[model samples]
Target: MSESLATDTAKPLNGRLAPPRTARVVGLGHRLPDRVVPNGPIAERIGVDADWIVRRTGIRERRYAAPDERTSELATAAARRALQDARLKPADIDLVLVATMTPDELTPNTAPLVAEALGIGAGAYDVGSACTGWLAALSIGASQIETGRADAVLVIGAEILSRVIDPGDKRTAMIFGDGAGAVVLSADGEGSIGPIVLASDGGMGDAIIASHEDRIIHMDGHTTFNKAVKVLVESTQQACERAGVTLDDIDLFVYHQANGRILRSVGEKLELGDERVADYVAETGNTSAASLPLTLSLLREDGRLRPGQRLVLAAVGAGFTWGAGVVEWGLK
Candidate 1:
């Protein structure tokens, strides 16, 4: 049969189905605390040299929220910047989703507080997947647009981890920071968002978990490192296949800023050059849910990202949660 005839036969009997609408990130913003804590103090408190902290985590300085700064406050600030970046007001948003594990208060969810502060009269909620929270929320927001549940949604990942980490615990004291990052997603005339893959291994959750007794973050560094590289590589490859693309087609790689060593290892295994991979851990230690989006925002601010570029985002969080997705940058 002729190629044209075969193409014509593939259409539905009634008519050709319209392509599904998709959510595209139209704006991005991030906010880090003004107070920057160098590794000196943290190392001293943990009875280690500053060089030891850097050699292990590749973190030189990290931000700590002020006494009055709460998770909600950081989230609100980031949201406002996102709205401004998209040239839209809070009233224009149809929904708000905050991806966070650290809430300002346990009684009230932080999303609603963020929405109220933004003066958005829309549905608001929270999603917790630890460091993978933002990617999970991105997938959810895209699905909402595809399903006609929302036209424009604001997604924020904010964390005030300073309040949660046990300062005396050397394992975590120098490895966490406080920050918030946000993106505005809305339906577009042309689809920009692509396939997303989310997975979890609850059985291995204990590898990276916070102790309930002491509320301190404990991680089997060696075990978690291996898992992170393997899962991240797998997830990214799956997303690329689902998006009908290849690894070489990707313009940039944005992975969760968990550890510098993990990032380098993943890049090496993927055979990707250093310039193709992003490294933000040196300036901001793992911010949990906020890491991915914060890194993205920084890229945008530095004029590193460009329109029509293909980006692959992957992340691994506590609970063994991990996700990857493809995005075609829609910004001008």
Candidate 2:
């Protein structure tokens, strides 16, 4: 995808503007916990059969961190792998942004802990937008890079939902997993990340929330499905329009790995066939903030994502937050 095809607004607002610096994803990696909890165990605990989980959620298994494993641990591991993948040292990072809903602690933020573990002497912070964390962080990272605030940034989405979920609550227990995914974003002359469309609806916030006492996730499946499908489809189309490209031009679609049903509905609304969408929910379940980046890492590992291809990434999160963006894949 050529930058010239982007809307004029993608360029500088005034004629005397400097040439925009492109922020490109240089590396990607993800880490899932070692313990794989199959549907059978979860089903048994929830008074259902293994087949029921697959039929309802399309989830066969999910990874759970050990008792001692924290969100920072998963994040640091992923950041290390991303640095290795980018062939850059931690010292090269100018900033670190972590997107996570579940942090090991309430204060101090998980990003700083991850940065400290990785020996990154840079600004670090956390972004909390539930499942849309990665996309939101990616947008912020791109802005920082493009505006010359930071030349290199590590954006990570990590979560340990297992710690917060009520194991007895079948709706939440069978859906979430623990994992982290990271991407190294750097300034590039030719590569581009743009047309990031973001929106939020605080009105539907209650559709998904954590219990006040236990912080356990409580969700209204029916309501979430309708809102997610509507927002995701709208954001995706807006992203493509802003990028001055058609949906047909997108080589791959990476929607939030929230639910299999939501993914299917979004694809159908976009008229994108199953082949174009990336499906990782069956294996990873809902890794919350880590979903998008995790899916990207899996696609890279499987050789499905190639350099120079146009990609569209969309997501809808618990805050009623949602977004989509267009990217020209540059990693090799």
**Index of the highest-lDDT prediction:** 2
Whole-model lDDT, model 2: 0.88
All models: lDDT?
0.86, 0.88
Model 1 C-alpha lDDT per residue in residues 33-72, reported as the tens digit of each score: 9999999999999999999998998899999999999999
Q: All candidates' TM-scores?
A: 0.93, 0.95
Off by over 4 Å in 2: 1-19
Per-residue C-alpha lDDT of model 2 across residues 1-332, encoded as one tens digit per residue: 44433222335522324226778888889999999999988899999999999888888999999999999999999989999998899888999999999999989899999999999889999999999889999999988987789989999999999888888887778999989999999985334686688999999999999865767899998899899999999999988887778888898999999889888988998899899999989999999999999999999999999987889999999989999998888898
The 10-residue segment of model 1 with minimum total lDDT is 1-10
lDDT of 2 at 238: 89
How far residue 260's Cα lies from its native spot in candidate 2, in Å, is: 0.9
